[model samples]
Target: LLWSSGDESRGAEQALFQTVAPFQTQVSEIERSRRMRGKRQNLA
Candidate 1:
């Protein structure tokens, strides 16, 4: 029973990670693009 409970928690944790991973990637990408644009403006 303890082993099964541990597995269930692990599965839930993995599901949460998969759900958030894409949003996290998108947020980072947006931040990176904004930084690049700022650099370009400075150059101009």
Candidate 2:
């Protein structure tokens, strides 16, 4: 019973991770672009 419960929790964790991973990548991409724009403005 304990092992089954552990597996259930792990499955839930994996599902959460899969969902959040894309959002994290998108946020990082946005931040990268923002930094590049800032640098360009500074240069100008």
Candidate 3:
């Protein structure tokens, strides 16, 4: 009973993470590009 509930929650958590993972990568990429742009401006 309790074990099954735990498994169910774990599966939900994994599903949520799977959905979020791509957005996280996109955010990191955006941050990286912003930093690069800042550096280029500083150099100029």
Candidate 4:
């Protein structure tokens, strides 16, 4: 019973990670791109 509960918790953790990880990565990339564009604009 304990083992089954642990497996369920693990699955939920993995699902949460899967949902949020991509958004985190996408947000980081967007911020980086915005910074690069700002720098280029400053140079020009």
Candidate 5:
């Protein structure tokens, strides 16, 4: 019974991660672009 509950929680965690992963990647991509732009401005 405890084992089953643990598995259920794990599955939920994975599902949450799957949903959030894309948004996280998008945020990271935007951050990377912003950093690159800053570097370009600094170089100029």
Candidate 6:
């Protein structure tokens, strides 16, 4: 029973990570672009 419950929780964690991973990548991409824009403004 304990092992089964542990497996279930682990599965849930993986599912949550899968759902969140894309959003995290998108957020990082946006931040990178924003930083690049800021650098361009500073240069100008």
Using TM-score, give the best candidate's number: 1
lDDT accuracy of residue 14 in candidate 6: 100
RMSD of each: 0.3, 0.4, 0.5, 1.0, 0.9, 0.4
CA shift of 39, model 4, Å: 1.5
Taken over the whole model, the C-alpha lDDT of each candidate is 1.00, 1.00, 1.00, 1.00, 1.00, 1.00
For model 2, where is the 10-residue window of minimal lDDT? 1-10
The alpha-carbon deviation from the true structure for residue 9 of candidate 4, after best TM-score superposition, in angstroms, is 0.4
After superposing candidate 2 on the true structure, give the runs of residues whose Cα lies further than 4 Å from its correct spot.
Answer: none
Q: Which pairs, if any, clash in model 3?
A: none
Q: Model 5, 1-44: lDDT tens per residue?
A: 99999999999999999999999999999999999999999999
Candidate 4 local lDDT, 1-44, one digit each (tens): 99999999999999999999999999999999999999999999
Cα lDDT of model 6 by residue, 1-44, tens digit: 99999999999999999999999999999999999999999999
Provide the lDDT at 15 for model 4. Answer: 100
Please give the lDDT score at residue 38 for candidate 4: 100
Query: Where in model 4 is the C-alpha error above 4 Å?
Result: none
For model 4, the local distance difference test gives 1.00
lDDT of 3 by residue, 1-44 (tens): 99999999999999999999999999999999999999999999
State model 3's lDDT: 1.00
Global lDDT of model 6 = 1.00
Clash pairs detected, candidate 5 = none
